[model samples]
Target: MTSVPRRTLNEAVTRFWSLAAPAYDFSALQRWAYRPPQDEVITLLRDHKCRRIVDVACGTGILADRIQRELKTEQVYGVDMSDGMLRQAMARSGDVQWLRAPAEKLPFDDGALDAVVTTSAFHFFDQAAALREFRRVLEPGGIAAVATLAPHQPPLLSRFIDSSRSLAHNPAPDEMRALFTDAGFEVADQHRVRRPLWTRMFTDRITVGVRSA
Candidate 1:
């Protein structure tokens, strides 16, 4: 597979989300489709006792703010490529240190984070590079959690979605697990999740991995 130029991908994604940032939190897609998995990812992070965590592609800082409050830590950070998104995120929490950065090039020291989580935005990432960055920043035994769109059922539909102009790649749960493994993480869990209403056409999944100590 050919790699997208990092600069081009960053520019395109940043432009798109920057324009959408103003109304992102109010969108039905955010409230209905993305919220459930975000809640789940938060629970997982809390369960694992992750106090120093960063939320990647953290649009409007919703998940990162929640993580900060729930975990009661000042170590929460939010990273996104869109300036508009970071601006909105900054308003959500004074505690969360919001940074404008891409998923593949996080601006942090290696092994500086206890956990890394990205929800509803992984499909827009260069999967391998993002995962490697996740692993690189996480301390040993730190967790990496991802929640993203599931591959459409019926191989044809999945292929169609992959080939769409959206520039997203929805991997099956197994493929996601494999990605974690290939990125040097120990695959800890994998499961499917769906929205309350559209349990069929739109689906999501969670994959958790642990860096070795």
Candidate 2:
């Protein structure tokens, strides 16, 4: 498959989300659809006792809110490029530090974060650059969780994938693993989990890695 140009992909994603922002909060379909799997991801982080977390590509702060509530850490921060999405996220309850920044170039010091988590946003990123940035921001032995829609998934997810065909750039699982490994993160766990497709079609794959100390 031919790779999409970075400038074109970024522009498309920004425009799509910017226009979708107004209707975004009203999309109860997104909440019920994504909550279960997001909860599962949070559980995984809890199991690892992750705090001082950075939620990369954190659209609307769903995962960031959960991390703050569940972990009760003041260290929660979120980064995204879309101002519209970031505005919606800031409106959400919790003191999450939201930054308008791209995942490919995080605005944090090297080895500053304890854990990093991203949900449903990997496919929109420049994966290699984003993974390298994740490595740069994470402290030694810090955990990183990157989740996105799996390829050839159920119809529910396939619809979103198709709708965003202009913007979606999902890499195969092995390719994702290689990106992380090449960035100095050891692939600790990688797998798919099933969840109810409540609204807006929910199907996802999660990858967890640790920065080598």
- Estimate every model's Cα lDDT from 0 to 1: 0.85, 0.80
The deviation in Å at residue 11 for candidate 1 is 1.0
lDDT per residue (tens digit) for residues 133-165 in model 2: 999999999988887776665665666664555
Model 2 local distance difference test score: 0.80
Q: What is the lDDT of residue 109 in candidate 2?
A: 99
**What TM-score, computed on C-alpha atoms, does each candidate reach?**
0.90, 0.88
Candidate with best lDDT: 1
Alpha carbon lDDT at 134, candidate 2:
91
For candidate 1, the per-residue lDDT at 87 reads 91
Candidate 1 lDDT by residue in tens digits, 1-213: 236666776688789899999889886767786788888888898789888899999999989988888779779999998999999999899999998888999999999998999997887888999999999999999999998877774565567456655466788888898899999999998887645765445667889999976
